[model samples]
Structures are given as C-alpha cells and as structure tokens.
Target: MPVSVLLVEDDEVIRRSVALALERYGYGVTTAEDGLTGLELFREGRYDLLLLDVMLPGLDGIGLCRRIRETSTDPVLMMSARGDALDVVSGLEAGADDYVVKPVDTSVLVARIRSLLRRTTFRPDPAPDPPPDTAPDGPAPLVFGDLSIDTGGLEVFRAGRPVALAPTELRLLLEFAAHPGIVLERQTLLRNVWDYGWDGDSRVVDLCVQRLRKKIGAERIETVRGFGYKLRR
Candidate 1:
C-alpha cells in the first residue's frame, strides 16, 4: 500500500501545492485547512505520517502534535515559514519528529518524509555482540547502566520503565548506542541521522541531543566541547 500522509496547513496555496506534489509521488495524502480539522481527520482516519504546519488556525501545530503524540507514535513532520530557532525547537519539543522551513522543495520534503518513515520501520543491519552470556549471533539489546535499548523492537527503557521517544530521538540514540564512547561530528550526525546530503545546520542535531538527553538522562550522552557528542560506555 502507498504511504498515507495527513497534511495540515492553513495556507491554501501551499497546502494545495504540497498535496498535489505528494500525490504525484504516489503517496496517499489527506489535506486539512486547519489544525482542528486536521485533528478531526486524524481521529477519523488511519495515516502513516503527518505533515503539519506550525502556524495554524484554532489549535497550533505544536499543540496538535502533542495531542496526537498522546496516543499515536506516527511520525510528525512540522513545516513553518518562521526561521527562528525558538520556533523550530518548540515544534520538535512538542513531539514533532522533524521540521522543515517553508518554501521548501517538494523533492526535499519528500526525502525528509521518507527518511522519517524509514527510521520507524525496521530492516536488517549489523550489530555488535550481545552482552556476555547473551546470544552472540543475535546482538542483544543494548544495556548501558540503567538504560536499555531494544534495537530490534525499537523500544527504550530506563530504570525498568518504558521510555516514550519520538522517532528522531530513537534513531539518534541508536546511532549513539551503536558506537559507544566514539565522538560523532555534527556533519556526520546530520547525514546519518537526518539524511541531509550536505553539511546542514548543526542546531537541529544539538536540539535533538538535548531532548534525547533529557529523557534518557543527561549524564549518559557527553559533549566534547567544540567537537561533538558520544555515548558514555
């Protein structure tokens, strides 16, 4: 089945254009003119992803993302005309998996959508040996002190309790946990985690790291001032 997308944008021109472009890419898209209508559509339909605009009527995109996140783990990609760091950071903190600035190319937007969706779905990949005494062939879930990461299951736990993470957060953690103690440069993180082909703004990575650290504990992910981040082994 084609991937389904719920597009919520208040601007008619952008909304219509994006919906058309997404349709051309063979995605099943449902468009809403406002956040309240989008929320209603979300409740009435099943979608694989949500393309939300940050500025919306009635309920804003940030609040709407939070509401959907309360029940759904579906990927949410927020779009905004605002270039302010605070605007983008607010959206991410509100449960959006990713954000895109407005006037974005349709192709790039599609790529972002694909990247987010791809991270949520599992595929075969190599892993290090499981902890001693665990299965050697099938890499066991990563255990670092109190934090537990089930790469296969795409779940996380801290202190024996489940931790709910946005798709981006989980993907970032997987990269960090995969190579414990190794510093990952900002450029490397952008390409690997965000799938940005070019050297993108590092602020996105920084904000994500901060949020991930907040949930998984601040001390585990260490910053090597002026370099990058690494997971403490």
Candidate 2:
C-alpha cells in the first residue's frame, strides 16, 4: 500500500500544492486546512505519517503534536515558515520526529517523510550476549543500570517497568546503549539514528537526547561537554 500522509496547513496554496506533489509521488495524501480538522481527521483514520504546519488555526502544530503523542508513537514531521532556532526547537520538543522549514522543496519534503517512515520500521542490531549465563533464545536484552533494552523486541524497561518512547527516541537510546561509555558525536547519531547523513541538524539530536533522558533517567546518558553524549555503563 502507498504511504498515507496527513498534511495540515492553513495556507490554501501551500496545502494544495503539497498535497498534489505528494499525490504525484504515489502517496495517499489527506489535506486539512486547520489543526482541529486535522486532529479530527487524524482520530478518524490511520496514517503512515503526519506533515503538520507549525502555525495553524484552532490548535497549533505544537499542540497538535503533543496531543498525538499522548496516544501514538507514529512518526510526525513538522513544517514551519519560521526557521528560527526557537521555533524549530519548539517543534522538536513537542514530539515531532522531524522538522522542515517552509517553502521547502516537494522533493525534500518527500525525502524527510521517507526518512521518518523508515525509522518506524527500524530494528537495532543484534544485542550483545545475554548478561553472562542466563541463556535464552533470540537476542538478549542489553542492561544499563536499571534500564533494560530488549533490542530484539524493541522495548525499553526502566526499573522493571516499561518505558514508552517514540521511534526516534528509542532508536537514539539503542545507539547509545550499543556503544556504552563511548561518546557518540552528533553527526554520528544523526546518520545512524535519524539517517540524515550530511543534511542533518544537530539540534534534532540534542533535543531528542533531552527527551530520551527524561524517560530513561537523565543521569543514564551523560553529556560529554564538547565531545557528544555517552551512555553511562
């Protein structure tokens, strides 16, 4: 099935143009002019991805993204005419998997959408040997402090309780857990976790780390001054 997208933009011109472009690329595009209607549509139908404009009527993109996060971990891509650091950071902090400045090329928009979707299906590499002895079938969980990461099952547990994480956050944690005690550069994280190669934004990595820390315990992942971030083993 073609990937489905929910695009919420208040600008008629941009909404129509983007919807048309996405359709041309064989996507199942659904367009809404405002945030409330978008939310309604979202609640009514399932989508592979979401493309939300930051500024919207009724409810803004940030608010909408937060609402969605309450119930779903599906990939969300935020678009905004405001490209300032504050605006971009706000979107990411609101649980957006990715952000794109408005007036964006349709090709680039499609690429970003594909990247987010790709992450939804991502699985971590085979886990390390199951904590000495206690043998089990399949890949074993990687334990860090009180946190347990079942890479094969793609589940995270904190102190024996499950932790709900968005795909981006889970992937980031997996990368850090895979390389415990080693500082992972922002660029390296962007490539491995976000699949952003060179066209990457470090703030995305930074904000995601912040969110992941909140769930898995802030002290578990340490900031390495100018180097990068490392998982506390």
Candidate 3:
C-alpha cells in the first residue's frame, strides 16, 4: 500500500505542487487549504504522515500540531518560509517530528519524509538473553520512585501500572534507563538511540524528552545544564 500524506498549506501553488509531486512518488496525497480544514480531514481520514505549514489562515500550524499531538502519534513534518532556528525549534516543540524551510526542493522534501518515516518505523531486534540466571552479574533494574524499567521485557511500569509509550519514546527511555544517573550528551544520545552517524540536531532529543517527561512524570528525568539528561534515581 502507498504511504498516505496529508498536506496542509494555505499557498495553493505550493500545496498542489507538493501534492502532485508526492503522488508521483507513489504516495497517496490529501491537500487542505488551512489548518482547521486540514485537521478535520486528518480526523476523518487515515494517513501515515502529515505535511504542515507553519503559517495558516485559521488555527496556525503550531496550534494544529499541538492539538494533533494530544491524540495522535502520526509523524508530522513542519514547513515554514522563515528558515530561522527558532521557527524550527517551535515546530519541534509543538510535536512535529521534523521541520523543513520553504523553497523546498521536492526531491529533498521527499527524501526527508522518507528518512523521518524510516526512523519512526525501524525497530531493533531483541537482544539475546543469557542462559537461565546462572549467577547473574549485570546491572540491576533502573528504579526511580514508582517507575521501573524492565529490560528483560522491554517494558516500563509506574507503581506496577504500565504506561503507554510510542516506539521512539520507549527506545529513548530504555537507553536512558540502561545507564541511570549518567548525563548523556545530545550527540551521544542521538547516535546511540537513533543510530545516526552524526549529531544531526539536538531538537529531536529535546522533543522526545518532553514527551517522555510527560508520560513518566516531569521529575523522573533530570536535565543537566548545558550537557544533556540523566535518569533520576
């Protein structure tokens, strides 16, 4: 089945052009003129990804992204004419999985979409286990207040209750829990958790951490100033 994409841009020219390009690339495309209509269409349809414009006529893209994040985990790629760092950060903070500046090359946009989708979809195979607890010598399970990370089952529980987590969030939390109290740098975290060769951007870590904090409690993870983050013990 073709990957479905929802395009929400007020610029008719850009919207139609991008939609056409996406369709040509074997993707199902749905276009909306503004955020409100786009969100409505999104609610009524099933799409694998969302292409959102930062500026819109009604309910701006940032607000729309926040609302969508409230109920959906579908990947979002934000676009803006303003190519400022603040704009990108704002979009990511609003729950966008990625951001792109305007005057976007269709080829580059498609490639970014592919990369974001790939990262969101990849799942590492389960690690091999040691033979039946014969004098286990590994680290103990990470325990922070009521939260516990079970490496064996790849599960997280708070007060014995399971907390629902997105795949990306789960992987991130697992990496942090594996090394409790260690302030992992953004570059190291990006390389280890996402398996990216370079540091890329740190916003990915920030956004994931925000989501993780919300799910696991704000105080569950401590941020080290100018460094990175550490799992609270």
Candidate 4:
C-alpha cells in the first residue's frame, strides 16, 4: 500500500502543490486547510506521516505538534516560512521529527520526508537472552523517578505503563541514565548516541535532545550554559 501522508497547510497554493507532489511520488495524501481541521483529520485517520505547516489558523503548528505528542507517536515533519535557527529549534522543541523551511524544494521535501519516516520506522533487533546468572547484582530495574529503564529488556516504563519511544530517543535516554547528573558535551553525545564521526555536525545531538525532552519532559534534562546537557538524577 502507498504511504499515507497528512498535509496540513493554511495556504491554498502551497497545500495543493505539496499534495500533488506527494501524490505523484506514490503517497496517498490527505490535506487540511487549518490546524483544527488537520488535527481532526489526524484523529480520524491512520497516516504514516504528517506534513504540518508552522503558521496556521486556530492553532499553530508548534501548538498542534505538542497536542499530537500528548497522544500520538507518529513522526511529524514541520514546515515553516521562517528559516532562522531559532525557528528550527522551536519547531524541534515542540516535538517535530524534522523541519523544512518554506519556499521548499519539492525534491528536498520528499527526501526529508523519506528520511524522517525511515528513522521513525526502524526497530532494532532484540538482543539474545542473557544467562540467568548474568543479571546485575542490584535492582532488577533501574528507576528514574516514575520512569523505569530496563537494561535487560531494553524497554522503558512510566508508572508501570509502557511508553512508546523511537529507537533514537530510547538510545539517548539510556546513555544519559547511565551517567545521571553528569553533563555530556554535544560532541560526546553525538559520537556516543548517534555513533557519528567527530567531523559530523553536533545539531544531531540538539535535535535528539529535543525529541527526548518531549518524551521525558523538558524539566528532566538540565542544560549547562555554553556546555551541554545532563539528565537530572
């Protein structure tokens, strides 16, 4: 089946153009002219991904993203007319999986959509069961407030309920939880969590941290001025 995409934009021209492009690329497209209608369609339909414009009538994209995060784990690619760094950061902080500046290149937009979908869709293979005696000496589960990180099962629980987390978010959380209260520089985080080479840009760390904050709560991660970040112990 074709991948279904929800295209939410207030501009009639941009909306129709994007919807046509996505349809041409074998995506089954659903469109909404405003945030309220977009969100309503979202609740009623099963879409593989969401293409949301930052500026919209009723609720803005950032606010809509937050609302969607409250209940849905589906990947979101945010579109914005503003191309500033702050704009991108704000979108990421609002729980977007990726951001694309407006006056968009349809080709680049398609590539980004593919990339975000790929990352969100990936599921790592489960590790083989360890021997019974190999269990750690202390607590059976590592606790972080109401959240539990199960090293053995590679799963996370919040108040005894399972929380759906993306693979990247899960790995980043585990790394921070392993060294609670210790600040990790962006470079170190990128190398360890993303396995990226030193030459790669550190913005990957920022994006992942934003995603993690959305899941675990922003107050749970502390930022050290001009340094990096740490998970609150």
Compared with the true structure, all predictions reach lDDT values of 0.89, 0.91, 0.84, 0.80
By summed lDDT, the worst window of 10 consecutive residues in model 1 runs over 120-129
Cα shift from native, residue 147, model 4 (Å): 5.4
| Best of the candidates, TM-score | 2
TM-score of each: 0.90, 0.94, 0.80, 0.71
* Candidate 3 structure quality by residue, lDDT tens digits, 1-233: 99999999999999999999999999999899998999899899998999999999898899999999888878888998987887888888887877778999998798778876776674545555657865554435567899987765566788889987665687789888878889999888877765566457788788889988998999988899999999976
Return the lDDT, model 2, position 50.
92
**Across residues 14-94, which tens digit of lDDT does each residue of candidate 1 receive?**
999999999999999999999999999999999999999999999999899989988887888999897678878888778
Alpha carbon deviation, residue 221, candidate 4 (Å): 5.6
Residue 49 lDDT in model 1? 96
Quote the lDDT for 46 in model 3. 94
- lDDT string, candidate 2, 159-201, tens digits: 9999999999998998898899999999999999998846598
N/CA/C clash count, model 1: 0
Model 1 quality (TM-score): 0.90
Cα error, candidate 2, residue 203 (Å): 0.7
In the order shown, the candidates' Cα RMSDs to the true structure are: 3.1, 2.8, 3.9, 4.7
